[model samples]
Target: MGELFQEAILVSILAGMIRIATPILFAAIGELVTQRAGIWNMGVEGTMLMGAFTAYFIATATGSVWLAVLAAMIAGALVGLIIAFMTVTMRVDHFITGLGINLLVAGLTLYWFRMYIKGRAQPTFDGFDNVAIPGLSAIPFIGEILFDQRLLTYMAFAAVPAVWYLLYRTRWGLELRCLGENPKALDIKGLSVSARQYAAVLFGSVMTGLGGGFLMLGFSDRFLADITAGRGWLAIVALIAGNWMPRGVLAAVLVFALLESVATHVQVLGIDVPHQIFLALPYLASILLLMGLRRQSRQPQRLGIPYFR
Candidate 1:
């Protein structure tokens, strides 16, 4: 009986880990794309909040989850463009600019929510439904574990390979990488550095937007002020821990998710641990994970540095 209970406990935690990991996976992948272009966009947290709010409002207004997602992506893209215009096009410091964007988005989201949604926790709405993969979903423990996830979760996995191919296997990726490593080189080759940088930033923002929308339409059903809850920052760190590869990022997200799952399990089992400490586990673990590997990890050499012609 004891052994059977333990087995059941393990499986339940694994399931929860996958659930919590979905949003993290989405945000981390978005950050991965931005960093690969040599700029660290730290406004992801604010952008995510905006995405959540906007998706919620649209979903409430239209009664269409799909339209809410579309609006969220557009919102994120515009926010991304603002960052790009400030940093890439105008030659501002990427860090300072990103911070400003964060502040701006936070304030704006709140102000608008007050005027429109009247500062409610969120506009009430139903969220997306989970999906079970055919055939694969029935295959014992692993099958049930892996195949019975929601749509966004599957996309997060699919994004791994898709980003990998885009970043490492294509001509555009070649040029984008060149822009990151050596913008002058791309310019010398008659390519427009600012344009490529703009594209990278905006493109990265689309992912950020999707990550935020996933929270509304995919994971949870509502929004709160600063609803992203530092997951955006975690995603940035995840990009580093992932060694900046899509596959690596995915693995890192999974590991983080698993830690979060265990933390949740520890609480649920009524263990004699500080609830606050367990709550802090994911962030603390991320910091330790980064510190432990910082010496060995290699980041983009030109990261956060803007290039001038």
Candidate 2:
């Protein structure tokens, strides 16, 4: 127990929390944008899985992580296009469309993976490494944990402010927020609701794809089935818990990641508790957090409602 409180161990846990939180932060922020635009996209899980698989396949094939990331973003954007077509153009039920996307992507990725591998040895590729900031990384406890991180981690944190500014300070952002709250108002003002929604969904999809790509390139060496491992769903939970705000979503992701990091260290310390319990700790914490914060969640007024001319 004392080892758990040691400075080194504590620092490791904090660093792990940041590392683990990266993927969720990206997905949650993306989803926040989608939701803010009045779209309830439940296909984030499927989009992430597809992104992960695409990144892994491209990296193994061409040995270019950059290409892999690009391919993954394109794949995600394609999926987002389908969702936009169904909900915005076809007027399909948002929930049904999103769930269908999830199911389709899951089955499709699994089948494609089996066919591609053909029982051969799984291919591996070099992944991103931690880059230490010259002076910042030298700080005793705070430096190593915060400054020395993968490039994707830095990008994820940077996105929080960027997203905030885009949503609150930009004209396009004003239109998007208006679309979510009342598409009719925007429509009356000669704005194109469908066009703005399409753009928002595409942007969100790209970010979600990048999140999945990072998971593959920044964390694991080889591709695994469902590598996203429910992080997409967790991201949605964080989005709701954060009440659809960028900074709030980040806080939610960090809390969940911190819990996960603690669970991981408990196993590392050889605690006598059931491993399953530790595995479930982060998820349980998410549920509890959501319940506590649900009342405060102020979703966009038109969220999940199909906007029509």
Candidate 3:
């Protein structure tokens, strides 16, 4: 236990926490926006998987990380469009629509991957490299943990404040919040509820896609089925645990990531405990945390309720 608190191991754990939390941060913030607009997008897992697969495919085919990222965003936006069409335009049940989308994406990506690889060796591509900020990175402990990180990590953290400002400081945000609380009020003001919902869904989907892309390009080398591995679901839980606020969501993601980092280190330290317990710690913690937090959660009144104007 003393060795676990050593400066080196602590720093490594902090750094790992930040890296592991980046992807979840992206998805959680995006979901925050979606829910703020009264749209409960349950297909985040599918959207993320699609994004991962699309990014992997584009990178392997063209060898351009930038193009791959762009493609993944587009793919995610398209998935959002489908969700919007069903829930917003068609007024289908939000939960059913989202679940269907998840199933569709999961099956489609699996089939597409099999077809693309055709039993050949898995293709690999170069991923994003970490950028150490000049003066900041020179700081003893804080610098390496915060300043020396992948660009995506920086962007993910930066997004927390950006999302807060957007939700609390802007007219669009006001309308979005109102949509979740009372779409009728916004409609009485001559604002188009469906349009705002569509925009929110699209924005969230793009962010989730980018999260998926980063998960692949920044972490893994080769594409595999379900590479997201339930991170999207974890993001949703974080969003809920944080009560759908950007900063709260960030805090939730960080806590989950920290637990995951501790789990990894415990295994490495060869602790005499069941490895499965450590592996399951994050999810178990999340479930317990959510159960404790859900009663206190201040969800939007109209959340999961489709607005029919």
Tens-digit lDDT track of model 1 for 1-309: 132258668777777778777777777877777777787788888778778888988998888988998888889899998988888878788889988988998999888877776645556788888789889988877765788887877887788788888889998888877766777888898988888788888888888888889887876776677688777887787787777878778877777777767766777777766656655666676688778878887577788898877
- Candidate 2 on 1-309: residue-level lDDT in tens? 577799999999999999999988888898888889999999899999889999999999999999999999999999999999998889899999989999999999989988988999987899998999999999999998999999889999999999999999999888899888999999999988999999999999999999999999999989888789889998998888788888889988998888788788988899776667755776777678778877776789999999878
User: Which stretches of candidate 2 lie above 4 Å from their native place?
Assistant: none
> Which portions of model 3 show Cα errors greater than 4 Å?
290-295
Worst 10 residues of 2 by lDDT: 273-282
User: Which ranges of candidate 1 are over 4 A from the true structure?
Assistant: 1-5, 119-122
State each model's CA lDDT, in order: 0.79, 0.90, 0.90
Among residues 3 or more apart in sequence or in different chains, the pairs in candidate 3 whose N, CA or C atoms overlap within 3 Å are: none
Model 2 Cα displacement at 109 (Å)? Answer: 1.1
- Output candidate 3 Cα RMSD: 1.5
Q: How much is 175 displaced in model 1, in angstroms? A: 1.2
**Tens digit of per-residue lDDT, candidate 3, span 1-309:** 676799999999999999999988988999999999999999999999999999999999999998999999999999999999999999999899988998999999999999999999988999899999999999999998999999989999999999999999999999999999999998998888999999999999999999999999999989888799889988998888787778789988998888878787878988666656755776777688778876687799999997876
| Whole-structure CA lDDT of model 2 | 0.90
Model 3's TM-score against the true structure: 0.96
Candidate 1 displacement at residue 18 in angstroms: 1.9
